[model samples]
Target: MIAFPDEAAGCPLTGIVASYTPRLAALAAEPGFVAAVDQHAAEIRERLFAQGPELMPRPLRRAELTDYALGFLDALAEVGWDQPVGYDYAVDRLTAICWLVHQNGLLDA
Candidate 1:
């Protein structure tokens, strides 16, 4: 498991991953899982960057991840989502986002 800094532990995005890390790790052992997660991360990264320059004029930094995670949660709430008993695309994407953030050293930035 990636050990984020103490400061990063309080981040909502970190919390999101904490909930799913066990499953994500198991999935990582499967063939092609890493690639799929990477793809999802790429998609989400693009979406974040696509936020108008006025709102995100610079590349996304670690500090911005919390806001992004909150926005994602808000959107899920808006759509009336319920946590699934099994894996789903949202979970996969979120796990992927967490991995992306960790792998890119964003949490430490």
Candidate 2:
């Protein structure tokens, strides 16, 4: 498992991933998975912005936010929870998410 900095653990992206990854892995091919991705991605965007510009990197860009959230979701969708590979993939995705959020300069409250 990826260990996010204590600060970033509360982030909504982190929340969504931590909460949904297992479910997603099990349901990736299910009918509503695509909708769920969209819904969660949107929620991530809303929550991120709600954290305020003061908490984010200066000159925040929308593109990066979308890319990271979507990419994370896509990663989760690619692996099955029942497979050992899925565990590794989850770790990798978590790592990427932590790095991206930090690289973008989001500060935890």
Candidate 3:
């Protein structure tokens, strides 16, 4: 079992996803947006490799990233879906998502 201090036990991904699902869902609905995110991730991969391979892990395909994004949104819907989430929060989530994709890749890939 994962143990976190009570004050920090809330999952950042879960909270961020829950807070921003509607916006993410809307973006996910657009093929253009998904493609752009994939392209951006590819760029990120290149930049990350420039830093060094030791910093990277197994690369994730664009579809896998999209699946994770969409799944996060779906999980959010299961909880309270009426809370208002800010645009800034949505942007932050997007940035973090891209960073996650980058971190999950290896330089050789």
Candidate 4:
């Protein structure tokens, strides 16, 4: 069994999806980022959550979570989703999502 000290053991993908939603919302509010990001990411992101989030064996610290969220957002900025990016971007997104879950925090911070 997993034991966290006075903390929630949340799912990482959910946090990323939540965070992505807000960023997407804000970006959509932008002049052209919306169509660009959507045209770029819609289908690729569909595969992002295909099997749900893969959790970490150990609980994450707040800083770790923040780093993860940044990693994901960075991947979005760098990859935009449809093109071929190095696997580093994929690793960042996946790790960041799992970290977000462990921290029980959204990508907002």
Candidate 5:
């Protein structure tokens, strides 16, 4: 039997994929998803400006902010969450993942 994941266990990306994937598209799509993506991406910009984008081998440029955020949301929308209802939930998870990945560099390799 298929088991739906809880809030924290599943990544935001999973939620994105679940809702938008061809195998399972969201019954209701969220209109605010684009705005949410912009908001999330803006946060990345602020962070990069404040500290630095030296997470990679070489330093990243400030212009990469929008692209990264767009890519991130697009990735989640395209491959992670799949439900319109899960947008906010995905945002919560995205916030954590963003902080972990960018701020703390927890996901940095």
Candidate 6:
């Protein structure tokens, strides 16, 4: 099994979410920020769940999340994406994914 950072401590995923806290806080003054995050979370959830004729939410194996996260980071690197000093959609999406992973206890798997 791939080892993930300890969630209780300072996981990189958690840190990523925390790093954007200020931006999110500032953006909270306007509408749509929370909605955008919720939408991102839904997207991440779809990626993490099995897709088929079933209607229920069947979570894929934990390894899938690891793969998804690594692939995302890889894609960012391939595109020369850098974390901007200001609000960035990529960072927000990643933060949402991290939050989902943490909330779903995928890090422990």
Q: Write the per-residue lDDT of candidate 1 for residues 1-68, one digit (tens) a residue.
A: 22233425446766665665665776647656666677887777776675664765446666566666
Q: Best-fitting candidate, measured by lDDT? A: 1
Off by over 4 Å in 2: 1-63, 82-87, 107-109
Each model's backbone clash number: 0, 0, 0, 0, 16, 0
Task: Give TM per candidate.
Answer: 0.65, 0.31, 0.32, 0.28, 0.28, 0.66
Kindly list the per-residue Cα lDDT of model 2 for residues 1-109, writing each as its tens digit: 2222332432345553444445545445754544544454345555555565566624445355645555655555665333344334444444344444544554333
> Given candidate 4, what's the lDDT at residue 76?
62
**Candidate 5: residue 4 lDDT (0-100):** 28
Model 4: per-residue Cα lDDT over 1-109, one tens digit each: 2111333344244445543444434453564544444443433334333443664233334554444445554556675654233223443344334433434544335
Cα RMSD, each candidate: 6.1, 11.8, 11.1, 12.5, 11.6, 5.0
Cα lDDT of model 5 by residue, 50-102, tens digit: 56366443344523533444466666656656545455655543543343234
* CA displacement after TM-score superposition, residue 14 of candidate 3 (Å): 9.4
Worst 10 residues of 3 by lDDT: 1-10
In model 3, how large is the Cα lDDT of residue 100? 54
Question: Per-residue lDDT tens digits of candidate 3, residues 52-88?
Answer: 5576554555545555555645655566344344333
Span of 10 residues, lowest total lDDT, candidate 5? 1-10
Candidate 5 to native Cα RMSD, angstroms: 11.6
Candidate 1 lDDT: 0.66
Off by over 4 Å in 4: 1-11, 42-109
Candidate 3: pairs in clash? none
lDDT of 1 at 42: 77
* lDDT by candidate, in order shown: 0.66, 0.46, 0.46, 0.42, 0.43, 0.62
Q: Local error of candidate 2 at 2, Å?
A: 16
